[model samples]
Target: MSQLTHRVGVALWGIPLLVIVVLIGGGLFALFLAVVCCLAANEFYRLSESSGAAVSIGIVCAGLLPLVMHFRPDWSLYFLALGILVIALTLPSHRLENLLGRFSSAAGGIVYPSLLLSFLVLIRDGAWEKHYYGGMVLIYILTAIWICDTAAYFGGRAFGKRKLAPVVSPNKTWEGAIFGIIGALFWAVIAGQVLKPVLTVPQCVIGALIVGTVGQLGDLAESALKRSAGVKDTGNILGPHGGVLDRFDSLAAVAPVFFFYFKALGMV
Candidate 1:
């Protein structure tokens, strides 16, 4: 099959199941996120390695330690994350030379994948369960982001005339962004209606805009990384769609933002 066919097939087959499993909310949901975190971290490590940063496979396990400690919020996962930070920073500056440069690369590894991705872990462990309402928020954030992406594609094709951030994602445009936010708001409304007892329309619209904007920013952030890496995409795992990181770029960064917003509203 062509790459386009491959891409469409994967999205069609995977997104529904993934969404349903996530909406169900339980050990299965947490486990699924853990797996996603693992894959994203590995992809980040791979990109870092290709960009001339050295990292051990053990770091993946080390990265997961924060999630484990998240069960006990009283204890600072920061300390464990900091420990990993120190070790990674201290990684023999002489191993591949450019001591300071290596240190910077190592730092990005921790920030982008490990620390940022851990917020979902915190959400799962937090006492957000008023009938698993937090799960609804999480689901909405992801769904809104996905809608943004989908809307961007069709909107760009149909009406895009100005670049939104050409340096980051050229195919994305102001027109597409407008459509994305609209699409995000549409889905957010649906989600709110579906979980009517849990969220109000105003809350749903605001949350969708917040997540959609943040998710788009996250996508741009990942794009910056890919630009730095001198690649067209993150990997080829999804054929024309790129790799796991490419697919989940916004999801990773948006998770933490959603956590923060929910906290401010006392939703999670």
Candidate 2:
């Protein structure tokens, strides 16, 4: 099946890169990944209708992703403000049949993805070290997402009886969601035990829970965006898996939040 082949192909492409980042280092690696984020953001905006809200390229630019990667907490504040400002500016002073909700819709599409994804760069620079565990954290976050998603898939297939969100993602079920949480927590617990020297168990558990939940929510959020834009997937760059953006959607939101917690504890 294409699905099985797709999974295998993705892992083949992804796992080697994961090893490189984790073992070699995460500093320059993280910097190099900025393009991925930018393209992802751009594609998200491109998918929106002309009648959508105004996409604020300037807003995302003003907040300079690289600057945030340097680990300035202040950058996030500016980024947030810029998002709001763009959104506000995009609002129509007057609504009419003649005037569509172009500004508001595009604003939402752009602001939504950028605001969450910018945190990835922030966290990439802020995690444990600029180099060592930063890569590991990135891999770890995605691995956690994978674990959650994998468990959800199997669990749902075997015991899915209740709908989770039929409108947004019809395939997701309550059973799948619950099992996904358990799987995420289980991975976090194991990582906590093994990686305690770098990170504590309690922190691992809590961070995993927070990241996994938010990551799933981020996926759903992106799904909503796609649906609103009248698209099935974001792109087809990665064969059956869609684009890198589709793959990283969940992890993007997780990176910054988890990185902040680590920073607060002086891990970064």
Candidate 3:
């Protein structure tokens, strides 16, 4: 089957499931995120172990950290610090040598999808007291990501010339990246007007540029991870999409950035 066909088929089911979870936005959303973290963390640990890194504790932390952030946002930093310390101290029990490699790999697994993706909970749950606007903001971000990815894919296929990152992601092109940014900017304005009208025109444009660029970079980062692990896809969970990490890599990257962007502007 064609890539486009596979993509559309996946979207048919995935988009509704995601919307339902976003609308629910409480224990249900937390549970959804916890499951995503677990799956992504499992893929990460599998990749790390493929490179001979011993990382078990970090996997546990990755699965649990999102739930903690959902329940106790205040304690997240302390929990991260405590998790790091514990990982550092317990390195010897897992592997007496390669302590640095083990610790760093494990820490990265916790931070990437676990810690960064937790900000989606903040965007949906902690950002505002009102459910409607908060949910809209979450939807806006997700829409921006979808727009960016779609634009990039079609744009690259149609007009790709100069490689964006020849080493990291050979398929990406500068033309595609530009189109992705344009798509994000266009959607940000539409989303602001139709969904919330909370952001100014300038804010929408700037946020889109930032989110679009960073989201692409996040995709590249995951590509680099897979390249390092000497694999094509992270796992087979999503068939044509590869895995949870494959689908959510851009989201994981965008969530923290979007959260802080709104937070800095006092919008959230």
Candidate 4:
């Protein structure tokens, strides 16, 4: 089948499963996210290792601590500190050359997709007392991101001129970026109406702004990583979409910001 076929096929099944898991918002959701973060971290580790950074499997294993510990945020800091310490101490026993590179890359794995992705659990379970509101918020943000990505793709194809960052992502352009943000805002207004008192139109607008703008930054960040590593796609785990990290790069960046947005408004 074609790349676009694979993309649509994955989306057809993946989006529904994701929506169901988000709505569940309990141990099931936590477990689901845990698996995702782990997989993403593994992909990151592989990419970094391929780029001459010596990332240990232990780092990927350690990354799971913060993800699980997010459920009990009381111990989240302690786990993060411990994860770093464990990685640091264990690094010396390895090849001994480029020790710092190994340590930094390994520790970074725990933070990037692992630590950042953990915030999704926070957004899903900690955002609202009403419980379902958290799920709705997640679904809304996800849809906004999708719309933003779609708009960027088509908009760039139709009217791209100035490069957004030609060195990092050649296909991206200023026009596409603007179109993405606009698409996100439009979805925010529509979804906000559907969401009712749970989220006002203004709040959704801000959320969309964050997802649309910052999420693209997340994409570029991953692209930079791939460019440095001299790879086209991160991995083929998602078929045409690439690996777990590639698929969720935007979420890896967006979740933390969105969670904080909820926290700032005292919604969490």
**Candidate 2 structure quality by residue, lDDT tens digits, 1-268:** 6788887988797778766754554355544454565556556666764433445453354235544545565666676566656655555553444344555554554444555555555555554533556656666777788898888889999999998888988888989878888898999888887676677778778877876588778778877777777888888877788876688788766766776777788876
Residue by residue across 1-268, what tens digits does model 3's lDDT show?
9987997898899999988889778778887898898789889978887233335667667777777878898898998888878877777765567777777777787887899998888877754656766666777778888899999999999999999999988999999999899899999777767654566667777778877889999999999999989999999888788988998999899888888888898766
Clash pairs detected, candidate 3: none
Off by over 4 Å in 1: 24-27, 50-54, 61-66, 93-96, 129-131
lDDT of 1 by residue, 43-79 (tens): 7766766333245533454355445545454554565
Look at candidate 2 and give me any clashing residue pairs: 51-102, 52-102, 52-106, 53-102, 53-103, 53-105, 53-106, 53-107
As a TM-score, model 3 comes out at: 0.92
Tens digits of per-residue lDDT, candidate 4, 63-83, equal 565456556777777777777
Worst 10 residues of 3 by lDDT: 50-59
TM-score of every candidate: 0.85, 0.79, 0.92, 0.94
Q: Count the backbone clashes (under 3 Å) in each candidate.
A: 0, 8, 0, 0
Query: In model 1, how large is the Cα lDDT of residue 49?
Result: 67
Model 4 alpha-carbon drift over 4 Å, by segment = 50-63
* Cα lDDT for residue 220, candidate 2: 82
TM-score of model 2 vs. true structure: 0.79
